[model samples]
Target: MASEILSTTDCETIVKNYLNRNDFEVMWYNLKPFFSEVNGFLGEHLLLLIDVKIKERTTTLRFFTKRFPFEHPMQSQYLNSMQGWQREIYFFETFLPNLERTLPGYSLDFVPRYLLGKPNDIIVFEDLTLRNFDLPRKPSLNLLDNQHICLAIKALAKYHAGSLAYEEYKSRELGKPYRLYSGEEELIKEPLIRKEEGFLGYDWFKAGVSGLRALINRVYKGEKPLEEVNAKFEILVEKALQLMFPHSNFRNVLAHGDLWAKNIMYQYEGDSSEPINVLLVDFQLQRYNVPIHDVLLFISLTTNRETKQKYFTFYLNYYYKEICNQLQSLNVSPEEVSMAYDEFLGSVTFIMPEIKIQGALQRLQQCGNKDFYTKLLGNKEEFIKFVFGDKTPFALELFDTDDNFRGLLTEAVEEVIESCLYPEIFREDCYRILEDTLGKSAYELKQYKTETIDEKEFLFKLEITVVIEKNEKEFKFLVQNKPLGFAKVIKKL
Candidate 1:
């Protein structure tokens, strides 16, 4: 294992090494960023696989990583996975390739290749250009249906099946216990509360950072409004970090610490009948977390009624069923899924209200750096506007991160399982309704050829199912060349 810390220049050198020789030619070098508001270690920047040329071969690749960042040196690293940070890394580095080789041909979907160089927290993987947005950072352009939700859940379960059996599948190759976040992040070298006031948010240039303008006066004085609330929010944030470790016992499983929709990929196959594959990207954030983080990230990030209503339950069931099927295929006794699920996510629901689904999604979609710069003088976007000609996109004053609705959804998923356990309870009418919505609204659905298996023929093809319009009342948004409405998912060949 070539495990030594790398610097920014080293990352560039390594990329050039790979590009100049066998597989690819360097086209564009993009710098990945981290969000200061969030965890420091969390990688917001990933190498965008632009063009590859090898052995008389040329190809194009694209996959996006949501720009999560770290603001100052004080930002603390945290975990959102069920198994926590430690397990997250373990699953990806250890479980991924091994599961593909072992386990009777069961597979998980994530970006194909990644680089583990130091310097600005770099991770590189397959570009899911075909797939739509992950729930968090979706530009309000794409729409998802029940099936889309289902496949996402299926992807989740398949992930669990591949990962849950880490020890049996390929434990020896599991280098360095790719578990919850333990490594130190250069950016976040300190804690939250102890940081200097100026580091809290950006200075109030246009309007300035909220919460703390006068540090000694307010922080020491115990400002009435924020003192109690800030204290509690900070505490919950820590709990959010701690929640990653579900059980100290079964610490071997792959967990996508940040499993929000932004990380999900959708290949629009133009056919509603075929099973649409949902692939994952961004692995630097991968760590040992409780399974619930995946579930929570997926459901909470993607289940905004804005995107699709009632998908909360739709996706949960999908994961459960897929997990069981994968186990059966691996001869691991399908029933063990419930036990695994139980192990990963029992006794932990309603931990804290999900930050409002939309608000969280917006945060997920944004780059931590822009969020960082905005805070410098306060108002990241406005700061950008101050710096440049175009103004940056800023959130509405009414944005809510309370997570009250998130809490509801979390409870609903865990409790609703009993009511909708049977397959019949899964709605056929729902699928029909989505098909109609998408079919009627599709201004033009273009099927794009996808090469699934590289050697022989195009493996999995996708159709660019871009819906031109939608019901404004249903899914509201401002699009450049489209109407308003919720987009549906159909797998028709």
Candidate 2:
């Protein structure tokens, strides 16, 4: 075994944990262990390719295992400090079981069956490769393609729909709404938004930052680029961190939470480039949040520049339709599942900052994307300026040139404007309802959409007033806009 994370004894225990009592006898052999280069910091992913025999049947099994004991010191730090293993256990044992029961047989196959999982021990799963499933020929490039994006979206839709169905079921049958795996755990005391440590508090974010820094040093050898990238990254990272765990006012569903190329596998038919099946893996970061959180993360991290530009809206609508269909299958009403167009758009915009951060880091650490990055990053002269961060200076060219990068920024701005405008729309609808009830003489509501001095301020710059003169006395109401919600209503002469 090349990985020190799991020993021969650990392997034996994993096998024993999965075996049935009905088996007359069982034997395990050829415990060859290898590493998956694609994985990032849920500790080391040790894949054990072994041959197993039960009575007359002999079959080969591929077991995916994660153990901190044998991982590199830094990897161990990320895993232990973040408590990622416990999350995986809860996902496998608690979340999946509940979700599976809610899904019909047609959709249940999207998730790979796990053999066994335990805290502080190895988690084992059936290898999709044995079933002729494969990693994308070019994960970096393919993720940017329409085929892959659609496949991921469809699978995510099913997962989210199933979760929502389960939630509704619990509410009706159990007298309470169902909670997600994250809610089951008591450890998540602090919300990510309030954390002063920015996005660096979580182990995964720390690991990503470390990887990005390493990539910058490797590509451009100067302190200046490192400092520049870090400064820009810190701002984006903070925003990205918040988006990763959005406080969505809309309904929440179980997010895969760590959706990326390696965590999702696509199975194809007869050497076809198109995938017939998509399976989600690695639920260690699973959270209860907006379903769009997963959708945006998948699109941002995997889909290419042109694909994002062309199909981002199409993809969103397609997923919404799928959700509607899935919910109907579960007997949920269409009214309850009415598509939140604004919510999806806002989330897509929210995730724009993370697109570059995640994509750049994934590309840096990816094994097959060497030629891809080498082409996009630069020639010898440009490379020198990028590394040194001084002299002629090499700015990150991808943000300007890449279609996806520009699209993310554009969508982000649009989302911010919409976020500001939608409230006024909501208030208008509310006023109509109130006016119908009150039989008003005259009322006027005006809203201003003004950009602020501080770029991050999300509130609509507005001044609103309402006047009603009745019974020889005039009543006036006035209010100002605030991000947390409309400020307390004021009465004036």
Candidate 3:
């Protein structure tokens, strides 16, 4: 394994040496990025696939080399604070392989195996795609449904259970706690908490809340006024951030910090819609945090509104049961470690609003970086504003059009409203907003492909039939061919 990045020629040389087969000849090889622009922001992903010929037999081999700061901007403070590809290298090299001894029955082999590991802030792994692993269709645009969600949750439970077992094994054998990554205890500290004020002063936290407020105000005008609850918003966001970090009372398991739908892959059992296996890629954001951190983030960010409404409790129970079962499989009692439903719900409720805010921004970001930057206008001071620009299309535009984003936002919004946990003022305010907009109404959204009005705008129409006050309100109106980033009553009667 090279400590530093190798050039094209150097990569070929290392490949030859690593293969260590004189009888084989490398036929053709190429390197490509593993993540698309939407799924990836940091780190340079160089996936190399090579074909080799040995004794008139030709076979192909694949390896993935991920180099941080390869082409991405390493200047942003938020991006810099997230620097830890090497931690993942440590995970794959020293920690993951022990799953066989730790939990012999469970299959924790979903992750890609490493061909080379860290020395110079880079790690290489065997590509799993060659084994027929694939991302969900329209991964960036689609919401993960219940079946796939279950698979992902189970996979995460197994990984967490394995980590817990590994920790026990290390204590028994090494006579001390095992550190999977260097300075892991310190490195895994929550980024939202600053030295003095905690998440209250964190820029990302502030930006997320501010962006949510702006979007709400713009979309749900004259209802759900959040101007006065600014301080309350900050407080709630702080509470949620606190819930994310590990405490002494809870068992700290490894969390896949960025657990969105895009980072996970699945393989089906021969033309069946049900997925038989799941794999989690992208460990750059790995941290030692509560399992709920991964669980909440994944569910909140990935599931659609309908899924959450129908199966939120079911999914939580599912994950909790899986955790208990997996730990018990390793002879650990569930009561001792499993997070109770009440505690889990508390964390989920507190964090849902904040996560929804993030989910919106991330969806808007998926529209395109170029569009976002244009709205940004080189104004770092107004970054949050840029993130919610009207001109810029966001996932919200697809709300009435696409079921996935809509279900996700709807579930998030409804969960927060149902909790009644927000400050009375904020809760009442938002409640009124929902009642005025969607109350007593069953809205079925419809879409039609229309002509472009001009180069700057496209002319599209959304039709909705809402039942309210024992009356049906149906309306079709033209929207200026853009992603409606916020919920606005275009023609509500």
| Top model number, TM-score | 3
**Which regions in candidate 3 have their CA more than 4 angstroms from the true location?**
1-29, 33-39, 51-58, 75-79, 98-107, 118-121, 138-140, 170-184, 191-202, 219-225, 269-273, 338-493
Pull out the clashing pairs in model 3.
304-407, 305-407, 305-408, 397-484
Top candidate when judged by lDDT against the true structure? 3
- Model 2 lDDT at residue 403: 49
Q: For model 2, how does the per-residue alpha-carbon lDDT over 71-177 read when each residue is reduced to its tens digit?
A: 34443444555566777777677777766665555346667767666576567777677676766656354354677777878888887888777777777778865
lDDT of 3: 0.54
Candidate 3 lDDT by residue in tens digits, 188-271 = 655433424322225444444454444343343223445544444456555555555565545567777777776888887555
* TM-score of candidate 2 against the unseen true structure: 0.64
Instruction: Give the C-alpha miss distance for residue 40 in model 2, angstroms.
Output: 5.0
Error of 1 at 163 (Å): 1.4
Better candidate by TM-score, 1 or 3: 3
Candidates sorted by lDDT, descending order? 3, 2, 1
Worst 10 residues of 1 by lDDT: 478-487
Local accuracy by lDDT, each model: 0.39, 0.53, 0.54
Off by over 4 Å in 2: 1-21, 35-40, 49-51, 56-60, 102-107, 139-143, 176-178, 181-248, 337-493
TM-score against truth, every candidate: 0.47, 0.64, 0.67
Note each model's CA RMSD in angstroms.
Answer: 16.8, 12.0, 12.5
Where does candidate 2 clash, by residue pair? 5-70, 143-302, 144-303, 144-304, 220-387, 221-387, 222-387, 222-388, 225-389, 305-404
RMSD from true fold, candidate 2: 12.0
